[model samples]
Target: MAYVPVKGGEAAILNALDLVAEERRGDPADPELTLAQIRTQQARAVDRVMAEGSLYDPDLAALALKQAQGDATEAAFLLRAYRTTLEQFARARPLETDRMAIRRRISACYKDLPGGQVLGPSVDYSHRMLDFDLAGEGAPTAPRAEAPVAAQMPRVPDLVGNEGFMEPSEPPAGDPAPGDLTRDPLAFPAPRDIRLQNLARADEGFLLGLAYSTQRGFGSNHPYAGEIRMGEVPVEVVPEELGFAIEIGEVTLTESQMITSVKGASGENPKFTRGYGLAFGHCERKAMSMALVDRALRADEFAEEPRYPAQDAEFVLYHSDNVESSGFVQHLKLPHYVDFQAELRMLREMRAARRATEQEAAE
Candidate 1:
């Protein structure tokens, strides 16, 4: 059977939009969410928006989240689209992660560290249960007693490097001008900077799936969580008139370091390698996934064969953007009457020809 093109009414389309709007604003009696509430209370969601959107304005991110009805990808899309209207004044000075005000810091590769592991606010060990109190007035809980935070913590990679365990003593501080994925069109065999930028904005769920694949032996590299840290980091930008850079503001960030054991390809001594991930907020899951994908996508750079989908840079980068991928998926709903009609006509002709051939054979 051939598919037939169905005609639609514009009135129905307009009514459907109104229904969607009404659905979004269910029960007017319920207290409406304020921008400040979303910004402060839902800080993690806002942070995810900022990180994926590649914009750090908390207030704007909050607004985008509210506008998106708490959909992170939609909020990110809103932020990313709005980011283009603003002028490109100047690029901020490179971040100094060493100076990050450590909040939640931990290591999986080691039992202890120089500064000690701080298990800051985490749901890792929490029981998954829905709180009915949240429907009304929620019960308050006292804050946990925290140990005095260290002024500075040594990076896990640095620790491993001190023990002469890593192939490259320290991760390369590649001082190259960062690529603007928004401005430049992505190309094959992308540079490391561009690849990282894409991963930074890539859909979290997509990245997570890819990362999980590697862990399940699809693209095994023997990864261990070297370190994961979340905290506020000061932003600094240099103006043309001012010779020195000045602090603009501070924003929350999550950084992940993934270490993997590898056999040297050229008969060199086997040593540990690293994959780095950094994002705009307290997003450990995203950061870890980004780190895993970061290493997986670097198969070519490491002279390793692409054994899985995660290792294929082109496959990962091209399909990673949420906005692009989501839009493409949604576009299928739009009317393609002319195109569908042509396809249906072709199918009908082919079917008719096949029937005629059968009748002639019977005769």
Candidate 2:
């Protein structure tokens, strides 16, 4: 049988190829800055890599930019590329909140603590303004070799825990074998670890949008930042070869716990439950939003009706991935000629059968 090419197929393919080539060339006006230049000059880009990609290697991110010719988007892609190659040598001992080298810590409660909450690099309660001084050329040079900050710091005593306002958290259990979501398709009814791992790698924009939707009454979850902390957390790993746990390295983490007041149930006391969020690097907004969504998902425990889109675990978790969503949406544009032909034939047959039935009735 003879076949004809679909109209505009060749043009569509050519246009796609051209777009790919343009992206490869990057921004023509910038003259393709070197990776070293981006690393040294574009600190914000490096910060973005650490935040969105969940990898803390500034050097690696810089190198990736150099390789991709200073494309921030490509730099993020490279960081994610490196993330896939890493093997979980061992799960770290669950972080003791008391042990965190608190760079920035805040709690919304009685204003006093043993160690007062340090508000570091936070934009909280501040009016947004575009500082022209920051945008000016030839700013004062930042210090290159500052002395290292002291590691040991005083812990912020939990007011609620101390005053019997809140129940103390149970000590984390010893390392359990977490299911690998990368290796296995996420099974129905996932564990908290699996869900968290997925969210850590979720697209920032997607999570932000979903979180915003909840505020717009999609799932009206009243949330308050119980605590948001950013700091260096030691990562301990046990090597199979050594059979002993050792400190591999430390990673900067942002953790948020949103306190939500749930309605009292029959024979049960009303209490504040928490939604948890944590991510690599200093991503307060993402962490905060994640915590709110996490709490919202636990609707049954709260004894309140869940109305928000954020409360829907399947919808939030499944849609938070950019790569997955982008690929699936774009795949519809691929050659589905065979499927289309099958559908067309079925429609034609149905029309013919209907016409025949009408003719018989007339006769």
Candidate 3:
């Protein structure tokens, strides 16, 4: 339903908007969903909204999700639209993931690595069956405790790098401040920084499909999951007067690193390249997908052919944004009266001319 208010359409628009609010409220007999409950119970949805919205406020994300009626992309769009009005104050300093409080860490390549594995809060090894017992308000199971994981878990990439087969994470010069896509318009052949920002906020399903394409042998770069870790990391910012950085708060993050090999020209060693992904909460799928696509987009650096859609930078970057995609599609529902009338007039004239020509031929 078109809700845009015209000069004489105020009354109709108000009624339409009220109807929407009523629909959103659902049955009056049923209990209304509270923002607190949504944020706590539907935590994954909140995380996704925060990640795609590029905002870290869980409460706002939860409200957006509620407002959007559980539609994740719509909620994300709402969050992003609201973000435009906020003024920038300070950019947090880069987070130190190594210092993350150990919660979940796993590796696909090696069963044992430095600091060992801590499969914290995962369903990977669990059965995929529904438990009807969970349908009702049941007794909550108290969380079991084990010996705390090591304070500092060295990243899996570092362990593999000691063998001298792994490629450096940074460029030859070094990793400069990543380009901000929010501040600048997206350009073709974007830097890793810009590419990463886009992928992080991209629709999870899009990235997952692209990542799967590489695994299916659509692209030649064979990959192995180097590491996946999720935990809380502190956000720090340095004031202009004070040279020291202070912690503002902590945000949960899931980081993924995938290793793929780059063939050397002539008679040279094939060094292992890295695909890195990071998501705003404990979002493993998005991070893993982002890492895979990140590697595939680096086809230029590896001097590999971009035979598949996954490897094409322009293809991935342009279509990955759900916010932009949804906006373009939803805009078609708005009034297109003038354009439609012009098309209708042209079609009528063409039909009339065709009928006249047929009569002349018969005569």
Which structure among the candidates has the greatest lDDT? 3
Task: Give the candidate order by descending TM-score.
Answer: 3, 1, 2
lDDT of each: 0.87, 0.69, 0.89
TM-score of predicted structure 2: 0.75
lDDT of 3 by residue, 1-363 (tens): 543436467787799989989989999999999999999889988999999998889999999999998999999999999998999888889888999986899999898878888888888999999989879988878878866888898888888787877886765366577778988899987888899999999999999999999989887878888999999999999988898899999999999999887556567677788999998998999999999999999888877888999988999999999999989999887777788999999999999999999999999
lDDT of 2 by residue, 168-240 (tens): 4452377577766666777656666777766766777777777677677776466667777888888777777
Candidate 1, residues 128-209: lDDT per residue as tens digits?
9987778876676787786778889999988887777775633447665677788999997798889999998888899999
Ranking by lDDT: 3, 1, 2
Total backbone collisions for each predicted model: 0, 3, 0
Error of 1 at 111 (Å): 1.6
Q: Of models 1 and 2, which has the larger TM-score?
A: 1
Superposed by TM-score, candidate 1 places the C-alpha of residue 182 at a distance from the truth, in angstroms, of: 1.7
Which regions in candidate 1 have their CA more than 4 angstroms from the true location?
Answer: 1-13, 138-147, 169-175, 265-267
Winner on TM-score (2 vs 3): 3
Clashes of 3: 0
**lDDT-better candidate, 2 vs 3:** 3
Poorest lDDT segment (10 consecutive residues) of candidate 2: 148-157
Q: After superposition, how far is residue 137 of candidate 3 from its true place, in Å?
A: 1.1
Residue 36 deviation, candidate 2, in Å? Answer: 4.9
| TM-score, every prediction | 0.91, 0.75, 0.93
